[model samples]
Target: MSSRRQYQREFVRTFFTSPTAVEGDDSAKMLRSASQLRGMQAPDAWIPDNEDATAPSMREEGVENIVEVVSEHGEEFPGEIHPRIVWHRDDPSTRYEGFQQMLRIADPEAGAVEHVDGFVIPEVGDIDDWKKADEFFTIIESEHGLEEGSLSMSVIVESGAAELALGDLREEMGNPSNNLERLFMLVDGEVDYTKDMRAMTPTGELPAWPELRHNTSRGASAAGLIAVDGPYDDIRNVEGYHARMEENRAKGMIGIWSLTPGQVVEANEGPLPPETERWLLDVGGSEVELDDVEGGQAYDGTELGLEELDEGMYRLEDGGEIHELDEEQLRERLVEMVSYVPSMDDIVDSMAEFEAAKEAGRGAIAMTQSATLVVDGIEVEISTDRMWDEATYQAAGTPIALFRDVHEHRPDQHDELKERYGPEVVERALDLDV
Candidate 1:
């Protein structure tokens, strides 16, 4: 396949199991995660940790972890070995360390070498971070013999500043070799909740739901990056885990991450699957019924072969007439199709099946958009691409909390904000509103 098509296709929907590099075999942990899950949808890739928090020896220990992983679980967990580079804002300057980390991976004679399929830069918030990312691409393509497109790169959205600067960061991606495909918003992990967000759940759900929704859907999607949901901390909370995964999936997140062996299955199956026996349809209200509804719905909620429906626009009953309807007519009459309730065991199986279909390129339900958010008490509209709808962001009751969070955490960057969106708008939201 050509590069462009392959690029868009492979990155769309894939779970990543991030095993701690300092301790056990991360890849093996991921394999176990997949195996335990009913669908057993093996992960698309395994990203080993190299950040200060997880691994002991930094990037070198991470590479060693991958080598051991390939040695022990080569046949079973043959996903890509992508190491994360440190880019924490609190650090004086960690972006430069990212380059060093890449060098450590590329330096085969130095002996910390492993197959470096890709890289993930954590806590990326500014233009300098983008420049550092670009430089990494240049070194891999120029010094090491590799096509930039032949590899995939990811960036984590961890800070309020990163959340706010997503647009500027996107425009900076003029370089084709950047290949910064995955944009994971950190839902959990060593996050300073007081600064970046207000919630701190061990489950995959966000502390601040509205902000999380905007970042995962608007900023990440609009930036042409696949949005990955973060890990759920408490591995024992299976019910909470399922709920969090379902919530993120509803918001257009392609996948979530796993830290331990047990989280693998539920982590991979972020949301439960599309009920094979059920029909999915939108509706005017929660109380919508099928009686007077047009053909956009299933007849009486009985299980019909997916082939029985023409893309959910009409029905194909055994001897019934083709109840065809146009898009406009379908829209006019469409009502929420009641979801089939799945038992606990059924959920386990369905999550796996849903994961399989998504991997096979047949899954991925559409996501809905947020209506409004209270940012510093003012309402801000979140755009479809998942970025702040700037024109209407300052609307009444839309809270520009992310903006305030950025301003509060990093006051030095206020000048940059003033320069980008003008001093008046930034000041009004930050100073007067709050």
Candidate 2:
């Protein structure tokens, strides 16, 4: 098994710094922002960006700023800090400079070494290129007398070769000298990737290469590492950002590159289950009302248009065809209509109920959820029964695991969780066993 530290990875906010000081200020902008991030609550991981975010002329000073600020306040920062180091697939001199900076920053004498989690290497090419970087890290650890594999590594899939390199990690893990197991996240960098591919668009905008995102997620899952999507540059479009997050969540990519603190908050809360219950239905590719009924059609019981047939029956109507369903059949149909994403409270309640059942010597049980709607002043009931076995319980463990990780790593978010889920539920979640 891997010895790398595992924690919830939701938001990665890159702190960009410039060498030039703002007018009327004595220090660089990066120092001021780094100090501010020490107290922020949203970013689960912070990246002190020294690559694209910093001007080429100021990179040396940028490294100094990282060493100074991180050494000063990193111990108090709640989030994991991974500084983005300069690197290139084809250039040796740039990689050498990055190595020298790593040596300086990771020196045991530097107070920042203990607080630094790892480094983010960008513009990676292939598996060989990856191993070269790993060797560099290994040498750094030995030079500073740090434990082997003590510092984790995350890489950006910015080139086609890097995209293909992800598939080779499992095989490479067997090498005795390889520290592939210490990898943490596979982050997407679409801008450079587009440049690498020589791809273009009519409007000169980066194409949404969804296949790349999916492959990144699949690769991360296979390697048991976190997958983070590329940054969304349209920061002002909050709705668009949320929409992108929804798409990423569907692709099993829960973490995102956040450019601002507000984006960090959005990404931090994006992967978590909703605060309240939500059920949606798609009828003929259109969303129809579930609570209100008109024209003798409603979607209360299934994705197909449902109409009340009798006291305990429903008619499944689609394109003028009808099929009658009895009470038991309608109950099963309701299960199909339940496009339900469980709330945090709902998950905790289910886990608690299952634990009680286990204590009573039961291996499995059926959990029932019901919904009541009043249409035209007449009450209608919709209900579904789901089997909760060991498998089901294990599958439901993600949200609970995330909650526990947050409680353990992000103490600043504790009060927010308490306010959202109440102190009792939060406490139980932290104490519960999977």
Candidate 3:
């Protein structure tokens, strides 16, 4: 083969092949070692430090950081002391204690704090109760500045009624007098837009909300800033990060803040690219020009419309309608899981006993009759049955003994029962609704 062709083949084999053949030659190792020695002999073996002091300084001055906020879908609170609407299942004390723990970092004193910000689901079924809850928060924000530097409260936005009245929520947040510096919208269960659909704060996906930073003005964009909780803590890709930061800057999001220095590093990673120092010099305007260098359209800029922002991630927006999958969809997903039969004879016997209990008119007996049919580790109660009918079994949604009846112990009685119930008795038994 030609020398150039061989080189090309070797290069392709190294990267494209699943596994490349190792060269039998050992001379390369010696040559590489000698080269390393040559390098060590040279006095200029040095590591490089590439840290930028300017961008962070600029951000510190006032530029907002772009944060993609998130929170666990099911849990309340991402372990922070931001605002939230708390609800309880017959117990408000637990929710109150949770807020107290979250605010422990703030050195919260129990008695000095005047009012507990919470609301009860009115028994009259009137949704005015939710309005009352929101009003309570407005009252707290209006009053708390005199005593403590901050107010911490939770509002539970979980119910059909609350979901419908989400507009009431948006209006409260929109109110200029209501100084809700940090608002947390806690969604517990399915909320209807008509009753209680509130925009999520600390916002990103459903539960991950950016902390709502309050602005002095109450115009359309008054709720201008959102701070993501638990800021980034890793700095693996500084260049890609700064590029995103420049994108966010263009999008009108201002400075980024982290509670910990570690998070600051993570947040800085993307905004501060690998060649950020050089790129900063290259772009060298009032704001970094990430789009010009990379040659792709800038991350959705401020000039772009909200419909364009939809192409990115879905976030909680005030006065917008959000729809989740219906119960049928949820059930369909659950039914997709695999179902397997068990292999325990003792469980089968126990289930048989339980079946006997049912035939005896003892209502429902709990026992292990078969490995497949079990309750709390005990099997089905149908003792004499074997090899259940797969089609009829699944259609019935319950287990029926394949062969014998409860009176198998008394063959004569078993025959009589079969005559009365007929061959389809097992099917009838299976038809009993769980």
TM-score of each: 0.53, 0.84, 0.24
- lDDT tens readout by residue for model 3, 347-412: 233344455555677654332221121112221112223343333334223222212212221132
Q: Which stretches of model 1 miss by more than 4 angstroms?
A: 1-41, 52-59, 67-78, 90-93, 107-115, 175-190, 197-206, 270-272, 278-434
Q: Stretches of candidate 2 above 4 Å error?
A: 1-27, 38-40, 283-338, 359-361, 375-378
TM-score, cand. 3 vs. native: 0.24
lDDT of 1 by residue, 292-337 (tens): 2332323333322112234645332222334465444333332222
lDDT of each: 0.47, 0.75, 0.26
Which has the greatest lDDT? Answer: 2
C-alpha-based local distance difference test score of model 3 = 0.26
